[model samples]
Target: MLQTIHDLYDELERHRVMLSFQGPLSTDLITALLGAVERKMEGLEPDQRTRRRVFNVVMECLQNLFHHNANLTIHEGTTRTTDLPHGVVMIAQADQGYQVLTGNFMAGADVERLKGHLDRINALPPDQLREFYRETLADGTYSNKGGGGLGMIDIARKSGGKLEYGFVPYDKDKAFFSLNVNVTN
Candidate 1:
């Protein structure tokens, strides 16, 4: 099933460059995804700054998936069952830069809070964002159910761009939060 999804994504990548993977969304899978990205990037001539920014953006995006995914299922010996939370992440090459996209389900309140946070982060200048991130990390007072209130700000600062976000209403109580980060190479 995972291979089928990967193959479909690969077919779509012919027109637009992309590196995509889907699996159980476990910790092992996250490690493998990071390794795969590193390997793919090795052949390219990405400069040091671009490489570091891309790595940070990808890391934060995957961490978001680890925290927010709604459906977590484990299959053992032909029996499939739900486990923890899991979601899908895709990183693709864009005309101007690399785009990291992630999607996971979120409650309405969480969505609103995330939107507000992103807006505030977008409004901050680079120096203010850096200071805010440092202060938040040092203070350690703000933490969500998943922890790490600094991930979004870190992503924004590293990407050096405003986060492109969307909340698609999936039901009365839940919505899908999609985030995009673009890192120019």
Candidate 2:
């Protein structure tokens, strides 16, 4: 376990990681995360615009994780246990920019639906993406969780790149979803 800790530290340093967290999320935790990240970016990202852009992307990602997170119920041969909606978030420096990455456990069945949503957002150009954002806002259609489906769109606009995402199967009916976005400084 101690060796694993050292290895993890080495890996984080190699990747230039500024901040990382893993576990269930809450409103209070999110607020704290924003504060911590804001302070870190203020020191490392001298450009105000770049800092704001990255900060906004991180906010959107955390909100999505908290609001749209999928709950899980584990079954161990008749022993049932429901677990909190867990997630992972990391911010790292890249050659061209800063990378914001998030991952969460989700139902495998929802993967196609989310994949379609992301692909559609990736397909639109910037001008059209802005238009679509306005359109979504005007339509005022919101999920049961009360978001207007704007998080991913906003992330794309702020990051100014295609959303990189994938799913890793966790079990017969569950999977882990990962999202990666980059903001240039």
- TM-score each candidate: 0.82, 0.89
Candidate 2 deviant stretches above 4 angstroms: 1-3, 72-82
What is the per-residue lDDT of model 2 for residues 1-185, given as tens digits with 9 covering 90 to 100? 99999999999999999999998786789999999999999898889999999999999898888766566444565422245557899999999889999999787898998999899999999999999899988897888767678889999999999999999999987888999999976
lDDT for each of the candidates? 0.77, 0.88
Ten residues in sequence with the least summed lDDT for candidate 2: 73-82
lDDT of 1: 0.77
Candidate with top lDDT is 2
- Give the per-residue lDDT of model 1 (tens digit) for 1-185: 99998997777676354566553466677888888877766665358777778888888788778766655434664424355455667777777778888887766657878888899999999999999899888886755644568899989988888899998998887788888898876
lDDT of 1 at 22: 52
Q: What is the lDDT of residue 139 in candidate 2?
A: 99
Clashes of each: 0, 0
